[model samples]
Target: MTSPTRILILEDDDGLRTSLRLVLEDEGYAVFEASDAEKALLTVEDPGVDLMLVDLMLGGMDGFSFIARARPRTEAPIVVVSARDRTEDIVAALEAGADDYVTKPFSVEEVQARLRALLRRPTIGDAETEDADDDVLTLDSRTPLLFDAGAAVLRRGEEEVHLTQTEFRLLSVLAEHAGKVLTRTALLQHVWDQDYFGDERIVDVHVRRLRKKLEVDSANPQILVTVRGLGYRLDTA
Candidate 1:
């Protein structure tokens, strides 16, 4: 059997922590709780943890500091759950190694969905099947493919590809399904988290950016190739 996904919640607020523990446990995740950065560090010592949800404001060391210290020790994805809603706060958390962020008063379902998506994401070398086209795209076998469900940092071989948040999510959805040709609408829905009234240019611009990062010669692409009149596919051949 596949091991259970372990999740750590580091929030100083007792009520929020308790509620998250209850809700996430009900969602069938192994939950660990910590009220401060100090305890969070200790909790992460257990290698079984698959992901983390940390609050930006803690009693002593803030979540950003905790992330700075903890990142070197673990490869688990961290998602910041905080009351701070400013753009600066979000940017800071992402810069500090958080894979995602959630604001206060958010729905439990949304949080759970985001967590599931992050956990479901195949990091570098887990097993993956080829699409119907018989194309097999594998992430770099040498290094772990770090993804922050909120931003795009594509690592093709040895170089890290810098991408905007939108571009990152767009590439991530495609990378997850490496050899498949995803439709424009499917990309918009899954990556943009929206369904209707979307601009196709949004997809084009991000795909261009992703290609620039993933391809050795962007002018003559190799990895992210376009299918005529259909969409795009990560050439896994």
Candidate 2:
């Protein structure tokens, strides 16, 4: 029999933490719990750690710092779970290496769905498609997007443009349909999988994040452009 997928929950709130653990355990996932960043550090060393659910308000080290440190140690996807809904908080956590987030007041169903969505995302070093030459996406011959399937780094020329797992997945979709406008609904379905309970804003934030890293000029992007009332399309020109 295969061992259960392990999920580590790092949160300071006892009640919510327990509640999350119970719900996940009921779903047949083996869960490891920690009260703060310091404790969470130890769980990452375990090879069985399949994913992590973290809170930004963690007591000792705080979630942001934890994300920075833990990310380097583990390639497992990290999902930030917190009550903070500020766009800045969401963006910062993503920049800090979180694969996704869930605001507080979310249902256990939402948590389960997000976990499923994150897990469904391609693992590190996974090319967008098997036996496909489309892995390396480039534009303008000036800057090229190189995806090292073994390392999972999206590179421009020789420089590595670090991306969260979510960003990588989003870029992969855009690359597959380059020069074609994919609506927010299409993107959310392809990138987040079928069970994600998120809106177009999620798509928008990730695309903006991708532009900053993947484009030469994020303000007036040369590659990724928004079609008024339509969607986003990537054109090298």
Compared with the true structure, what per-residue lDDT tens digits does model 1 show for residues 140-203? 4354344433332345456665554345556667767878999887886676454233345546
TM-score of 2: 0.83
lDDT of each: 0.70, 0.81
lDDT of 2 by residue, 1-237 (tens): 999989999998999999999999998999999997877888899654889999999766999999999987877888888899998888888777777788998888888988988787775466544433445555644767676444566888888887766777777777778789999888888888875667566787778888898777789887778998989997743
Which candidate comes out best when scored by TM-score? 2
As for candidate 1, its clashing pairs are 136-236, 137-236, 152-168
Runs of candidate 1 with Cα error greater than 4 angstroms are 129-237
Q: What TM-score, computed on C-alpha atoms, does each candidate reach?
A: 0.60, 0.83
